[model samples]
Target chain A: MAALLETLTEDQRDALKELMNIAMGQAADRLARLIDTLVILSVPSIRLATECAPDLSDCPIFSAPSAYITRQSFLGALRGEVLVCFEQDGADELASLMGFDENLNTDEHDELMLDVTNILSSACIKGLAEQLELPASFGAPSILATNSTLFDKVGDVINRDQTLILEICFKVESHSFTCDLLVCVARESLPSVIEAINRMLEDL
Target chain B: MAPLSDLLRAVIDELNMGVMIVDPELRLELWNRFMAMHSCRTEEDVQGRVLFDVFPDLPEKWFRQKVRSVLELQTLAFTSWVQRPHVFDFAGSRPITGKQSKMYQDTTFFPILEHGNVTHVGILIADATERAVQHQIMHDLNQRLSQEKVEQQHLIEKLEEAQNQLLQSEKMAAIGQLAAGVAHEINNPIGYVYSNIGSLERSAQDLLDMVRAWREAVEASGAPELVEKLDDLAKKYDFDFIQEDLSDLIAESREGAERVKRIVQDLKDFSHVDKAEWQLADLHKGLDSTLNVVWNEVKYKAEVIKEYGNLPEVECIASQLNQVFMNLIVNAAHAIEERGTITIRTGCKGDEVFVSVSDTGCGIPEQNLTKLFEPFFTTKPVGKGTGLGLSLSYSIVQRHQGRIEVESEVGRGTTFTVWLPIRQPEKQVDE
Candidate 1:
C-alpha cells in the first residue's frame, strides 16, 4: 500500500501536491465565477489508491447512503479516471446555487450533477495537464451510482493494485455544499506523469 | 469498386443516431442521414452553413461555450435531455404513446484531434424520448401512490373517529336507559312511602286529641284514683314529650320522602323517557331539571346563578338538549378547582333561543379552543374524562338544527352558548 508513496521522492510528492493545489484552485475559481460565490479549495493530498478505498467509510460523504458519484476518464501523457463524490444535501445545495429548481426531479438532478462534474473535473484536469506540459483529453462526465454501491462501481473502473489517488476537496463557503474529487492514475502512468513533473521542475 | 471513404460514409449514414461534424469556425462539414432526416436539410445544403444559422432556437451562448471547451480542452462534452429537451427539434417517432411531440435528445461533443491540435468537433445526438417518458411515468406513479397513502391514512383516522363516537353514544344510551328504569322504580316506592307518612301524621294527631278529651272528662268527673293512675302512666311513658316529638318526626319523614320523590322526578325529566321526540319546550325548565340532576357534582365546586330572560318555547328533543346542558354544567364544575360561579343565562333573539353556561374556572387555551369539540381531545388526566362530552353536545346541538359556540380567556373563564331555532326545520325531522 505504501509502495506508491515510497516510490516517489519527498520532493516529487511535494511538487505533485503543489501542482494539484494550483490546478484545483483554478477549478474552484471557475466555479466561483460561474455561481458568483466564494469557493474554498482544500490542499490536495497525494496517497495510494488502496489506502483510500479501505478508509472511504471514514469520509463523511461516502458514509451517507445517497452520495452522488460522477466519473470522467482523462487521457494524454497521463491517463486515468477522476471520480467526484457529493453528499445528497451538498448536491442539492450545488444545484440550487446553479439556479436549478429547489425541487429537482431525478433527471434534472442527474444532469446537474454531470454538468458540475464536467466543469470542475475538466478545468482541474486541464490545469494539471497544462502545468505538467502533458496534453490530456477527458471523456464526458457520467453519473456512476449513488449510495454504498459507488465504491463497488469505482473499484470496477480503476485497477486497485497499481493506482495513485490525488484527493482534493472543494467547498462553497457560506453554503452547505462540498465535493470530493479523487484522481486515480495507474502506477504505469505515474512514470510518465513523474517525468512530466520533473521536466517542468528542471525548467523552473 | 467503391472507395473505402465511400463505404465508411454509407455505414455512418445508416446509423440511427444523428451525427454531424462542425469545424472550428462552427460550420457544419459532415451531416449524416439521421441528421438530414431530423434537420430536414441535405448534407450539401448544410455543409458550409453555420450550425446556429440552421437552428436559431439553439442556446447560442451555452452551445458556443460547450464547443469552445471541447476545442480548447480537446475533451468530450455532454448535454443531457434534462438540460435541453432537444437540440435538433426532431419529432417523436413513437406512434402509439406519442407522449412527447418533440424528441428528447442526449448530445455529445467530441474533439476530432488532428496531429496534436483538434481541427473539427463531432456531434452525436441520441433520441431519448422513450426513456424520458418512462421516467416521467414512474415519477407520476410515485407521486400518485404517496397521495393515495395520505388519503388512506386520513380515511383510517376518520373510521377510528366514527368508531369512538359510536362507542360513546352506546355507553350514554345504556346509562340513560338504566337511569330511566331506576327513576321509575324509585318513584313507586317513594310515592307510597310519602302517602303513608301523611296518613300516619293525621292518625297520630287524631289520637292525641282523643287522649286530651278523655283526660278532660276524667277531670270533670273528679275521679282522683283515675287521675292519679293517668298521671303515673304519663310519668312512666313521658307521654307529653312523645306526643310533641311524634308529629315533628312524621312531618320530617314526609319532607324527606318528598325530596326523594322530587329527585326521582328530576331524573325522569332529565332522561325525558316519556316526552315526545320533538315538541315546544321551555329552555329554563330543561336547565333547572338538568342542574338538579347534576347538583351533587357542582354544589361543592361552584355556586349556580340563573339569569333568566323571557324565552319562547323552542321545538327540540328535550332529553338530548338536557343531556347537552348536563354535559356543559358538569364540564363547568370540573373546570373549577375550587369555589367558583356557574351562571346559567337564557335569552331570545328573533327566531332563536340561546342558553349559555358560563363558569368562573380555568379557561381553555387559545390553541385548544378549535379542537374543543373534537372527540378524544381533552386536557383532563387519563381515565378522568372520556373526552366525548363536548363532542356529543356539539352533535346533539347540530341535530336540533342549532349551533354551540364557545368563548374563553386563558386565566378568566369559558362560556359555552347553545342556540336553538324557535321552530325545528321540517328537513331536520327527516335527518
Candidate 2:
C-alpha cells in the first residue's frame, strides 16, 4: 500500500483519506439505528492499493475447504466492492444468536447461517450508500469460491498497489464489527472521485 | 316495483350472500333481498334505520373506525378473528375466492364512492359453511399425508431395524446349530460317563455287600471273639449309611446337566431365525412362557392372578406380542414394589379377544395418564424408565388391528386392556 501511495498526487491522497473518514462514520450510524444501539465508529484509514490482498486465512468467514469465493464489480468512476465472509465458528455463534440450539440439524444450521450473512451484508451496504452520497442500490452478491477455492484463483491477480481500502471498526452493544470499504479506480474514476470530494469539501 | 325489477329482486334474494347498502347518514338504504334471507330481516323494516339499531350486538369503537377507514380508503380485505374467536361460526368463507354466491363464511365490506368520495357503504356477507367443510377436508388430507410420510419414514427405519435383528438372529441361530451339534457330541460322552458312574456305584455296592456277608458270617460262628472284632471294626470306621446314599448323589448330578440343555434349546427357538413373517399363534402358550421368564420379578413382588378364558388362535406377529406381554408383566411387577397382585384376564369379546392386566400398585397420576401412550413420555425416574414401554405396546397392539386402553387412579392401581381381532384386520399405517 505504501508503494502504491507514491503513484497518487498528495492532494488526491488527502482527499481520498478525508472521504474515507466521512464514509466510515456514515456506515456506523446506519448500523447503530437498525440494531438499536449507540454504535461508536472509528474513522477508516485510507490507503492506495491495487487490491486489498488480505490474508486469506485471516478471513474467518471461509473454511479451509468448500468456501465460495465471489467478486462483485460495481460500475462507476470510483467503485469498490466489499468482501463478505461465512465462517464455521462464526456460523456456530450466529446460530446460537438466532435462538437455535447448538444441536440443531444440519439444514437448520445452514438456514441460520444464511440469515446472519444476509443481515450483516445488507446492513453494511446501507452504511456504504449513506457515505458515498451516490444512489446506491445493490445487486445480489454471488458466492465466488467455496472454502479455499479463491486462494488459487486470486493467487497473482491481487498484487496491484493502486487500489485503496478504507477499513473501519464499529463497536455496538458489545458486538465488534469490522467493515472494509474499498475504492477502486481505473485511473479515470480516480479524478472524478477526487472532484466529487472537492465539491464536498467546498460545500463543507 | 315493476315486474322486471321484481324478477331481478327475486334473483338477488335467492343468492347466498347478504348484501346491505347504507346511505350518507348511515341509515340503511338498500337492505337487499339477499340480506333479508340471511339476517332474517326484510328491506321494508330495515330501510331508513341506523345500522347500530339493526345489528346492535356488533363490537365497539375500533370496528366503527375500521368502517370509516374503509370509506376513507375505499377498500379493505383481511380475515379478522379479533372481533371474536369463533369467527368461523359466524357464517363467512374460511378461505374466500372473492365469490359470494355460495354458502361461504368470507365477508367483505365495501365503500361506494359516488364522486371520488364516500357516499355509501355495502357489506357483503357470504355463508362459509361449505368452505369450512372443504377446508376441513383439505386439512384432514394434509394431516393424513403428513402422517403417511412419517409412517413411511418409520417403516423404512423399522425395515432396517428388522434386517439388523434378522442378522443378529442368524448369528445366534448359527451358534444354536453349533450348540445343538456340540451338545449331541457332549451328550454321547455324558451318557458314557453317567453309565460309568452308575457302574462304579454298583461295584462299590457289591464290595460293601461282600464285606457285610463276611461280617455276618463271622458274627454267627462267633462267639465273644468275633463279636468283639465286629464291634472294633464298627468303631474304627463308621460305615453306617455310605452304602445307602452314594448312588443318589451320582444320579442328581446327571439330572442337573439335562436341565441346562433344555434352557439353551428354549432360547434358540425363541429367536426364531429361520422364519421372519408373523404366524398364527396360541395366546395362552405365548403368555405362559412370557410369564415363566418374568416369574422371578413377579413372584416376590406380586402374585399373578391368571384367568385364561377360552380363546381362538390369534393371527399376529408372535414375537412382538410376546414383547408387549413382557413389558406389561414387568410393568405390573414394577408397579407392585412389595407384595401386591396382578390379575390377568383373557376373554373373547365379539370378533376380538381381549386381554386385561390389572395391577394393585401405585397408579398413574391423571396428569401423566394421557401421555402414557406418547413416545418418550414417562413418570418413572430417569434411568429407571425408557418411556417406551406403554407406547411400544400401543404401537404393537395397533399393528395387530387392536387397541390398548388403560384405566388407573393415583394410589389405587392401573389396568391395561388390549383388544385383538381373531383375524388380521385390513392394514392401517403399519403396512
Question: Which residues of candidate 1, in runs, are more than 4 Å off?
Answer: A1-114, A123-167, A171-204, B1-4, B39-49, B86-99, B177-185, B208-248, B266-287, B307-324, B346-355, B373-375, B386-388, B391-404, B418-431
Error of 2 at B387 (Å): 2.4
DockQ of 2: 0.02
Chain B TM-score for each model? 0.78, 0.54
Report the C-alpha lDDT of model 1 over B288-349, residue by residue, as the tens digit: 98998999999999999999999988889888898899999999999898889999999999
Which candidate ranks first by TM-score, i.e. highest?
Answer: 1
lDDT, model 1, position B12: 90
Residue-wise C-alpha lDDT for candidate 2, range B354-384, written one tens digit per residue: 8889999999888887788766677678999
Name the candidate that leads on DockQ.
1
**Under the 3 Å rule for N, CA and C atoms, how many clashes does model 1 have?**
0
- TM for candidate 1 is 0.71
Each candidate's DockQ score against the native complex?
0.24, 0.02
Sliding window of 10 residues with minimal summed lDDT for model 2 chain B = B80-89
